[model samples]
Target: MPFTGKSGKFNAAIRTVEIGTGDKAVKLGGENVLPFYTFDAPIENAPKIGVLITDMGLENEVAGIKDYYAGATTFAEIAKKAEEMPGADFVVLRFEGADPNGENRSVEDCVAIAKEVGDAITAPLVIEGCKNVEKDAELFSKVAEALQGKNVLILSAREENYKAVAAAAGLAYGQKVGAESAVDINLAKQLNVLIGQLGVDQANVVMNVGSAAAGYGFEYVVSTMDRVKAAALAQGDVQLQMPIMTPVADEAWNVKEAMASEADMPEWGSQEERGIDMEVETAAAVLASGSNAVILKHPTSVATISKLIKALV
Candidate 1:
């Protein structure tokens, strides 16, 4: 018998979630095999890269990020430039100011900024909240309503606030909802279950199953993603079949290794270089572990990862 290669494709595929509209819309998931395993079967949609910008407008941006934007100072200017980044498939507008503990920015103010960014850029939009459950519930709902037809993905609907966010974003506004859970397979599935029970279409849900910087006990993150992908394809797990999108910027750049200045930790090399390295490594790790999309803040990281994806897939 002639030697033959066995195909590893599975019967089930990750559900396709489309954000944005018209020609600029991007698709996530929709592949039957494992990540980057095109040899097994054709990956229906290539993984996506999203550049994250906060409403803070890059005030304290690192040297690299500052240089990238140059004279673009306003939120709208930053967003437009981000949309035009080398490999940015979409732009994430994080409303960090909405955190009641910090800036205590009001919902109205955040909404105004969201609308401004929404109107300014044609690229797909993703709304990242300030992580305050109560504030996010209100902020996300209002932003969802504000960006109604933009088909944005609210990041995200947690256990405590799922009802309000999911209902408003997925049901009322006709946008996508992100079901976020800690780095646990069971938690991820349960949130998806809860979201599904809300009458939201499964196709409209994406998973943000938590993330961590590489080398920061990241094994757990990798294992969690690995199991989710395995169960989705091999075990036909519908609840776990949603595409995974990990936010790598906040987690990677905040780690002490990335944040420590060269003066404080001269052995760590350049602080900016360290931050970018952590981000790129973590994003690449998650992608290989089955993430369909990864959010990054550095232009070099985005360009590098984009080239890697192109070469691999």
Candidate 2:
């Protein structure tokens, strides 16, 4: 039987990829076929999930997750807690200067935080720079240097920024790099081609399909990812074959269903229940979309989703 009506001979089997550096890096699930389609090929592992660690505190940060980070005043504390969580597969350290309140930290500060988080975990790490193209190039260069040969997943590369970020990963960090794009198959392929032009090996790249929340643009993200996977297996596009990353937790947290409290939105029900539901639903959507890995925040959500993946696979 075909995996998704593409009429390919090979059944979709789950594939795995390890992100980050040192002992902290983790391996996400690998299946030869599409997600939950075990009849074609048995999935050896379940989809892996990572949590995001930032340098600033999330004040009033959505009711459900507020308590989890109450003790995590800094990224260091957050990383320590995440590393302690058995269900967490990887650690994604994001430089959120894109958020004006995030201190507008310089590249030096970003490098320091990356190194600190890198040293603190056994799971693989994903180092992302602020959205500023030129600034990100400079910052990612420092991150690659500080964690050289560490096999981390450096990210936020785009059509405009791929050259600099790709070059930095190849020449400075000697680590894997992640490329991001809106939900477009051709754009994803084109970015990978540009990365190749810079001499970055295909093996060291992860593609980000740019996921959205469950109630938001999730359908678009899911359909795009499914198409990408279908093309990867049937059309033999190596760019689409690389592992996929989804910031499901981040996307879910931003939704009103997750951030709103019982007092503000009684119609939404309890904040904790709503938050977990949003996270689990978002994660479930990503799994269906063929995401190899996801970055999540809540420990409860991770646990619940892990169970769901186990049951489905």
Candidate 3:
């Protein structure tokens, strides 16, 4: 059984740094060739999936999807459910309340949730803010300080708030930072440059290429991440070399395919299965597109995706 495309180059190759470090570390972009092509370059590490747990209950926007989790509440319950997957490498906790527009959650609340969940899990933790810039600055600052010695990824130092998030993340000792842009390659590069200017080490920075709904423009997201990785490996661009992050849960959780009632779309399958399918499909797509880390929702989805990843490895 010979493998496909460029047979056997990965006899013993470990060229790039695919994984990251924190409470839990992940490897990305180490495959010498396309996914599951055994005769090609051997894959160094399996693509990793992390589950998303919100700090507070879904408020205005996500309230409609709350039924998905049913009785589950709090990060602890989410963590317990995520552990059932067996392949989930880490957890990403988004402080939805801190968005200023959502629940207007305070910085203290964000810190408390991180402390509680970070202490309970051995997997690495990723902290994200609501879309609000001012509140994001305040909330991330506190969470960064709280996770201090704990190696966690502090997302989202944008052009608007890079200074604040970088300053705080840098002070947190082993804490790492993530830079996100909509789907622009140039913007993603610039954000990484800005974070570097802030005295944060490049090794600790992760780049977020962002994700889109299935039919709405997923190709654009996929192309941009591919381009970023190519520029890094072929052109040796330092900014593009940083690990890539994709929030599949954030995008997929709201799609009609995920939240539609089984009654409304029986042909699509059960709502639970539909939601999990959306996550697995989107995640596997990104894995092929060169994203290193993916933040996902639905415990069942994580489990399903993990199986897909194992088959690739």
Against the true structure, whose lDDT is highest? 1
Q: Write the per-residue lDDT of candidate 1 for residues 138-248, one digit (tens) a residue.
A: 999999999999999999999999999999999999999999999999999999999999999999999999999999989999999999999999999999999999999
Tell me each candidate's TM-score: 0.99, 0.88, 0.84
> Best to worst by TM-score, what's the order?
1, 2, 3
Q: Write the per-residue lDDT of candidate 3 for residues 1-313, one digit (tens) a residue.
A: 9875535343322234323345356655555444455556566666677777787654432332355555666767655555444667877888876776667777887788878887777677788889787888777788888877667788788888888888887654557787878898999899888888878888777788688866769889888987886677556676777767788888876888878887888888777667667777888888778776678876566767778777767
For candidate 2, write residues 1-313 as lDDT tens digits. Answer: 8576443335433245666555546665455677677666666766787777666556645554566666776667778787666577777887876344456787777778787877776777787766677777778877888998678888778887788888988655687878888888888888888888788877677888788888896678878888888887766666677778887766787788877878999888988788778888988888888888778877788888778777877
- Candidate with best TM-score: 1
Each prediction's Cα lDDT score?
Answer: 0.95, 0.75, 0.72
Least accurate 10 contiguous residues by lDDT in model 1: 54-63
Candidate 2 residue spans exceeding 4 A from truth: 1-16, 21-24, 28-30, 58-66, 69-74, 98-102
Candidates' RMSD to native: 0.8, 3.5, 4.0
